[model samples]
Target: MRIVFLLCSFLSLFFASELITPLPLHINYDKSKAILGKKLFFDPVLSKDNTISCAHCHNLQEGGDDGLEVSVGIDGKLGSINAPTVLNSVYNIAQFWDGRAKNLQAQAIEPIHNPVEMGIEDTKALLKKLKNNGYEKLFFEVYTDGLSLKNLVDAIAEFEKALITPNSRFDRYLKGESILSQEELSGYELFKSIGCISCHNGILLGGNFYQKVGIYEPYYADENLGRFSVTKLEEDKYYFKVPTLRNISKTAPYLHHGKVTSLKDTIQIMAYHQLGRELETLERDLIYKFLLTLDGDIPEILNEK
Candidate 1:
């Protein structure tokens, strides 16, 4: 019995090392471009009515999401999907819930053009507004070509690249710099042994790949077809890019549909629908405690004046 326990422990450690990694303390980004992008991200002039900005949906101050079931856009228009957290978004394999946009640069300009979101009707008009609103000089400071739509999104992407949150308690524990509580440790062990680590592995812990929402049971289908909208493939239906679990505690109103607000309920739902298991109340509680360790320090870039 003791030998069996030691072998299990050894295998667990091996899988943990192969499956998960600690986030880096810092990543490279063009600071000047990111600073300019920060300004543009908060500026409402990008909208047609000049009332909405990127920050309106992605509130960097908390959770990197707006805390809405679905985002409210320009002129009180409601979006179809929940806003994914911008925190550590740089690590995602692709952007948006649908994976429609290829990268952050592609993702940055999308809401500006979406009718219900930023609602910019004319690219030329937006350029004029930016030039008149002192953005031309800012663009010149960062880019030799001055202001343009390409550069605009490029700068925003650069800023998003710097939005990685590092040094979470889990990450410190992974690095052997800190230790988890007994409950947290047990919860993490369950996380790996129970197959959560199969999909939710990697630095950001679940952003690395796409997965179908319901495997064991049927999750209710909605108008949003997920990646099927992007690829037009039958197999792609209901397959969305698995979101990062980093800061899962802060970004409430979980999932692509944003139907579940309680993290415990979300856990139960995932267990039943995805894992085909019904967790006891105590198991859910311990998993919740483990998840809390994922909340990390805010990006230092947000602190820049």
Candidate 2:
């Protein structure tokens, strides 16, 4: 057992050295707020029932998601939409599938009051509850107003901004710091040639824009009107926020609906329906290898907490 453990550790270290690459260029965020945000993120007091934290939906150990088809919110009410991984969310052009929230600050306050989510009616009341706890000192130190809804959202947003996923194999190859196997490189070519990169570009990959799901294939019809809920435009029906591919390996159950499970299935679906291309078996395998490179290690603080 000891010898096996030693071998495993050695292998991990070896891989971490070669495969661990830094983030894509554009995701600029503050480190100072990230520390405070990480703590506030795990604190359940943010929820009205004092049961769920941000971690409930976006668990760090579970690739920043809770591994559910649909996340259960306050009182165990299953939310309508699948939860997206919080990892690399800082790269998202907008928040939520519907593109409802404009930034992290606006996004943070949403769950706190959602009857199905945190269930907190009042932000001030929630802050008051957490005031006497460890947050009080931290709050006072971080913000001038201290414990206000603005500060609460700001702090959480700050932490989220730091949750950027760098050091993926794709990133390493992109930086010219390392090279990918020929198959992986071939997969990247297919990915770009098939127009997958059109929307899923930039540092966060796909979060920079919104696109219609059925552009190539009919989206599985559901009552959940995506961006239409926000825009109220008839043309906006079935449109959803383009998700970032950073840590794609970890954030499974792809698409806004989470109908597809495997990365290969997703690639095939995209090619068949969206891109109007058919990928060969070797091509699909290469793409899968490239996608696998997106998985990353979690922050040490989140694990300790």
Candidate 3:
């Protein structure tokens, strides 16, 4: 057992020189605020009709998404784009498909007043309702301000910050604590050699930067000419913030539009569209298995709650 352990450790160190790094086991987050945020996240009171919460779209139990192509908002109002997983979302450069919101705190409040989403007729009324529901004390307990928009977004953002799923199988492999089969390792090598790592690098593996969605060819999505609407720059058209693949297997249907449902198909389409190369059947299979290793445990607050 000791010899086996040492060999595994050596291999981990040997293979740890990849582009992507492992997520830390713990993240710094405000616990009391996060707890309040958890309640807010799960509570359906945020919507105008009392039907939708933030969790309505990003269901933590279902890989932080509601298993829909485009998440519906209050009163069956359809949102234009796919709802990205909230898990590890704090790692993103910006929020939303067009990168509209700059941070999670900013992102949390948009839906509340949006005509489609939470659809609150009045923000003040929502606060008043929360206060009436005795959330004032809860908010005061966390942020002396209590139940205000600032405190609400802050608390919710704190919970999101703690949503990191550390120590995936690939992360264990990176840390030299676990072994990858030859097929998995081969797929990983292909992942590196084929240039997937350029955008899909760093701890969150693809959230750090924006890239053209279809470098080799034009890609049409449900978005309004991709990021161009945000920047109003013609050059920015067709560009998208590359999404994290941290829990890729769970957070499907894939892409900004949720167009592809199958992991194999997404991989193949990406290889051809982004890399301009079609992966062989064996290569796609191996890579798919490797991507599966990204699935890991959710945050402790989610489990404990």
Candidate 4:
């Protein structure tokens, strides 16, 4: 009853005003710093074995994710959770599925320190390597302090801030610069009417808040306790930071576990567990089509020399 009432309210609000907004075409950042960060992002030297880079799990060219159910890290270590797309992540209120990191800057250096990820145990050793490998000069050019961990992650965060994807068909439609097909339009209506907007409303269609994965029913039994891991509260047990829908179709194998590969299956699961409702075949198809329209243009920074 509560969910139904909220759904009705959200549906009404959707009609009254825009529930989602378009991504800006550009965001300001230090180009020199971001360029330096880009180099560091792709550099393997950050890893313990120098075999893994941020791009190893996040392939910027391909949906900003590695296209794997679980990320493969340094020494072929398997990550516990699926790798979320880095595109448009700057807008997220918090970072990671668990919302453990407060922001991009906080999230940047985590992988390097994670044993299963980049695994850089000795910070001083890593800094020494950076100084010898041309990064010191780059750091000097970008920051007066030269090479340091703070500046390192700061530059990487700046690059990440420039990773916003804009100009999706839906965004253009929202701006009255383009139009959606009737089916897509209907799908959008269904998305709002069916309570998806209750949790997914915002410029990113999510990422603004945390929500339980199994609001109406249990989705799965896993060791990961989502936000509970960070908060250590029983109430937070299945709650996760809502992911953005931008490039949803491309970031296959959805959810924190990434157990479901097909988008249709993922939708069905969300409908059953999150909404406690079953979607008809046509309805699911329509919603899927609408979601495809959410894919946006790649960040222009990727092409910058």
Candidate 5:
């Protein structure tokens, strides 16, 4: 009887709709590389002015974003797009809102030299600087190429890859360790019924594919070209990579430009603009509760800082 019950539980998950999937309990990554990368991630030496680090924009404490409408970077320059959360970014099909960089390594390289970001002018000079700054032994031990750009980014990417935050309320429910409250369960049903699951599905909820933000209505934001900047295809215009909802509650000022600050308002906007499903006030509240279930504990690295 016990074997039959356990097998039935396993089979239920397999037969269920693929609209939602639970995140793994934890991520697996190299400890040495992740540690090296963590130091580099928090080090502002990678910045031109020695004032900005990746954590400045993507602070792990604040849902992996700096909690600003748009991120302020090196030399106190403001960037055009909102800094997406680093938490669960490994699940994203591509990095960045534009999906320009193929992987995290490529994505990691750009911000170092981005004029509006870290503002590092020369790569070779930066590499030389890091080595001279007593990082030679660290890089050499972790990577065969020593302090090369590839090794630097790889170490950083390893750390980024380990940024997944699992074991949220919804994840616990999915794993059958806990149960959702009545309100949360209602919200979950509404979420599936309202077609939100169409795009926001899978392990990360919404990062697996690209979708136009305003399918039912036109989305107006300032100079936000999205994927068109990468592909230069007309159809690709306004198509941006949907961000993961794993830690959505803490990642405020939502969207590409960080235009929507309030979670409640953002929900209504997404429904009207993307799904064309006008939500009742109570319905919106329920959905909001469900979104809160997605919130997970912050990364341990952030707690140390």
Candidate 6:
């Protein structure tokens, strides 16, 4: 009877809609690279002021973002877009809301040189400075050639690759752990039944593709061009890459513009604009609970400084 029950459980897992991602979980990331990356991530040498680092925006302890609606850059200038979490970003098909970057390696250099963000005009000059500084020794220990612009990017990218937050309750359930509470199970069902899975389907849970922010209604009262700004294609207008829901409970002021503060409000907006369905108060709460399950523990190193 126990063997029969196990077989039935296995079959049920196969039939579950949640386990649909094409990518398998990757283990065994490089610790030395991650350590180098972490230092570079926190070091303000990457910024113009030597005050801002990647941690300024993608703060790990604060749900991988600094909890601002829009991020403040160097000289306290506020950016127009909301900062997304750095966690589980390794799973994303592309980086940035408009899919501007092909990988973490390419994504690493943009902010360092962005006049708004880091304010560094020349990456070579920055690397020369870093090479003469303390991280140079560490880089020499880690890499054969030491701290070049390419190696700096490589270290940061390596650290980002190690930022995966695995073993969520959903992942455990997928691995046949049978651990989700009744409310969580119901919430997961509702997540699927309401077609949230249509876009949010993946290991990263929504980073796999792009979708229009408002399909049914015009979302733009103020004309934020979204993907059109990147592509200059009419079809790409208002089409932003679907953000991963991993650590969703932490990474809010939600949405692209950071207009919505509450998850309940964000859900209502998404339901109305994207789904054409009005979520009841209780249903909204349930979906929120399921989203909370996506909040896994943060990496210990991120919290230290």
lDDT score at residue 99, model 6, on the 0-100 scale: 88
**Candidate 6: segments with Cα more than 4 A from true spot:** 1-26, 300-305
Please list the residue runs of candidate 3 whose C-alpha ends up more than 4 Å from where it truly belongs after superposition: 1-18, 221-223
Give the per-residue lDDT of model 2 (tens digit) for 70-108.
789988898877899888776678899988999989999
Model 5, residue 117: C-alpha shift (Å): 0.8
Query: Largest lDDT belongs to which candidate?
Result: 4
Task: Tell me the spans in candidate 5 whose CA falls farther than 4 Å from its real position.
Answer: 1-16, 300-305
For all candidates in order, the CA lDDT equals 0.88, 0.74, 0.83, 0.88, 0.84, 0.80
> Which lDDT tens digits does candidate 4 get at residues 1-305?
45664665556564634778899888999999999989899999999998999989998887899888889888788998999999989999999999999999899889999999999998999999998898888899989999999999999999999998899999999899657999999988888778787778789999998888887778774677899999999889888999998899999888899888999888888888888899999999999999999999888988987
lDDT of 6 by residue, 1-305 (tens): 33553353355445547544433355466778878998899888888778889998998877888799888889988787888888878888899999899999999999898887888987777977787678789988999998888888888988888777776777777677888888888888887766677667678778888888877566883457777888899989988999988878888788988878898899888888877789999899888888887766666545533
Backbone clashes, candidate 1: 0
Residue 238 lDDT (model 6): 89
In TM-score terms, which candidate is top? 4
What's the TM-score of each model vs. the native? Answer: 0.94, 0.86, 0.92, 0.96, 0.92, 0.89
Better of 1 and 6 by TM-score: 1
Residue 13 CA error for candidate 5 (Å)?
15
Clashing pairs in 3: 12-176
TM-score of 3: 0.92
Residue 286 in candidate 5, Cα distance off native in Å:
0.3
Q: Write the per-residue lDDT of candidate 5 for residues 1-305, one digit (tens) a residue.
A: 32553354345444446567887766788878988888899999999989999999988877899889989987678988899998888878999998888899999999999998999989999998898888999998988878888988998888888887877999888878657999998898877766677667789988888888787788878778889998899988888998887889999989999988999999999889877778999999999999999988666544432
